[model samples]
Target chain A: MENNNNIPIDDLTEEFVVNIGPQHPSTHGVLRLQATLDGETIKDLLPVLGYIHRGIEKMTESLGYKQSIYLTSRMDYLSAHINNQACSLAIEKGMQIEVPERAKAIRIIMAELQRLTSHELWWGSCAMDLGAVTPFFLAFRDRERILDIFEGNTGNRLTMNYITPGGVMFDVLPNFASSIKELLVKVKEHLKEYEELITGNVIFQHRLKGVGILPRELAISMGCTGPVARASGISCDVRKYHPYDGYDKLDFKEIVIDGCDSWARYKVRMEEMKQSIHIIEQLIHNIPEGEFRAKVKGVIKLPVGEYYQRVETARGELGVYIVSDGGNKPYRMKFRAASFSNLGALKPITVGAKIGDLMASMATIDLVIPDIDR
Target chain B: MKSLFQYLKEVFLGFYSLWTGLKLTLYYFTHPRKEIITEQYPENRTTTINIPERFAGEVILPHDENNKHKCTACTLCEMACPNGSIKIISVQEESEDGKKKRVLDKWIYNLGMCTFCGQCIDACPQDAIIMKNSFELSVYNRNDLVKTLNKPGSKLKEKE
Candidate 1:
């Protein structure tokens, strides 16, 4: 290292760069972080994305309305059901098809269950990121029950292309209500176990308490939503702001915390899981008896117009924008994914934090990288 | 005395927090049988696992005793597939009514590229193709995945 400045060769601490993933386990997917480090402190952080980009939006242009909905499931695999719902809702809005009450209730139930699973996975991974591995096992145990319920009802577990434009692809199974009730009871007990495992631990608290302090204004300006924004006191829950499906009918609280730290983000997701359970309980008993699918033509062609619909995924707001030119295929399709926007707030909060702190912050951000890349 | 008191307080607090965290894991470890969540793959294949009825594993055409399918060769599934997973091959033949009618020659579904979106099953107006529950689709060669849905010497089910 050469120092040109006359007065300060010894005083200047040379800053070096470190690359934290494109393949690191903590990244949760293929996200490369180019961090400028002065010792252990991150001076600057830049996230390099698109390692997993499959051109989902571009592919949607050629696909018909029904075919395009399936592509959204691949974008945010963690919240695939919600992603599919957003796309369907947008098409339904354009086509002006009223989804049946039963279908709406089922959609909300599925979305809430999907939310719980996503958060459960997040909780596990977040704990694992901070060096506690047991929570991963504990969280997955409960998450498997949710996946079982999803598989039993929707046929597939992860990429459930079950939600369609008119309604769900299939009706709920006969044991849907009982299975959910059983799951809700188990989950309630497990949430306490989770709290005991990590939330109240001094080590976990010390790592997360004041690390990555994101202010509400910064979160808002960065276009953060879901738990990340809500943690910062932004109150940006799309379910609360603009209710869709049967969310308007069911009652639930939007968990917001003013801590603006990693702890707050973690707590928000934890509380949101409880709220998801609450929403599911309210609707499971009363999934109105009616047609699961609304009447729609074989080939769905939306009139020439622009349509936009947004739904709250476990991560954040998933907005589906479709531009149709009086054709079966959309002329243009765009997805405003939550992870992509939340990834922007990472550098702002993580800068000046330690390398260990960066992992804590990133974990709390709860990024599903395909959602970012897509 | 003050310094001693501070050190003891910190020690007690730290141990208490650690104890709280370890308690749950200890309970899980002790009750291993009850807490075990993993499904033993391959070993427990026969008794434990029951694949759900609607599981979208592979697309198949159900044939009747007469070796006939319900496919009209409408190319609706081909159009519906997001990927070019479904390929419909048809031949124009003069029917008994002396009119040119397109008949199905081959309905090819490539399992390798199939996302199991159920769009093809939904779009099939004739209820010809459906997703089967057999999910063990792994094969030695990729060519094995390119399944021809229609049975050999199968004809379209005649209109009732």
Candidate 2:
């Protein structure tokens, strides 16, 4: 036993450290946050990452323009289509290829479907993180429908290397649009149930409200995008603002709120899901009959330049920065992950917040660690 | 004085919202048609993948009646695989006109490292490769998984 000095040991002064993850289920994937706590109040928060770093950027430099699409799937395993789209767009930019209009529509549909699927999973996981168990299955109930749609065309659920350089690897299946329309009805019905199960719950609101308060100015300064930023009333959705892949043709709105809390983030995601359904409904009917891909040259030699492609995932903005060296492969691929940038905001937000609020706060932050690591 | 009533009203409204959620989820549970969505994998053996005609899959050398393949043993597929999943050994044969033609000696397709990306299928110039709708590619023995389609001393006869 050591004798303490004249320092008073209050709850604030009584120090304790907790390692939140590396293997924790709520982390979504291998992300360790070392937090210094004083009686359930997080004092200092530090994110420890790089557990799932696959050196994808280095691996991409060796692969050809067409070969690098598979590597994108591993970046954000949950939203592989968005990752594939970003990479394909960069390659298309480098090689100066314009995919046909029909391909653009298909790409938009696939991306929106991916957005819906990713948000569906997020709804479930965020509910589970907040100690609500039943919504996980409810969200997956909708998610499996989306996965079957993906598996029908792309051949897998999670990692779809379907998007190619000039266009997609393959054309949309014959009944793809009709089948998706069928799933769309179910998704809308299920979303209504989700709103009931999680969104309106007092416990969920109590867990989320005024928790992880990221103010608008700080969010802007940190370059946060997607739902996290949109929660703070920042309307920076790439689909609406940048308008890639027939996004301009469709009618949709970016869901934004000024509440600047976890509940605001939750509301934005829920509303975004509704908007995604609306977009799918509008786009699926007008799918045109045309070629899905163009004839790309045998050997792709990218001109010496840099190309940047950004897409809004369920979590946040995913930036793919590619530099071409007039060769078959990319010279450098730097991913400016939304998770990485959003995780930086945690230390400022989590300070003085209760330990229970940390999970709610982290869930709102919505980090995909492999995206950060890559 | 009015602010106190407003705060109380909000508190009551929050409870109302919570009640709304509970009612909706309970309704779903009672309506069991919305609950289960699993398709039994083995039981539904007649599942339709609806594979397109142009889909690139496994690299088959197009075997004919004489047990001959269309592949000229160019070993292009071996170079295309990112994971070194394909290995092909070829031997040179002299034609009657004294021109040398490469004949396949050993063809190795390792399912262990194959990513099924269809790159090797595209690299073959001789429309010799096609991805068959064979999804049941699982095997207990690792050695049994690495299939060699071309046997030794078999000449690759051209298609009619």
Clashing pairs in 1: none
The model with the greatest TM-score is 1
The model with the greatest lDDT is 1
Candidate 2 structure lDDT: 0.81
Off by over 4 Å in 2: A1-13, B1-19, B33-35, B41-66, B132-145, B151-160
| Clashing pairs counted in every model | 0, 2
Model 2, residue pairs in steric clash: B57-B131, B58-B131
What would the per-residue lDDT of candidate 2 be over residues B20-82, giving only the tens digit for each residue?
877876777689785577666676667833433443345455576777777777787787677
* TM-score for each predicted model, relative to the true structure: 0.96, 0.90
User: Model 2, range A208-244, lDDT digits (tens) per residue?
Assistant: 8888899999999887888989999998988888877
Chain A: TM-score in each model = 0.97, 0.96
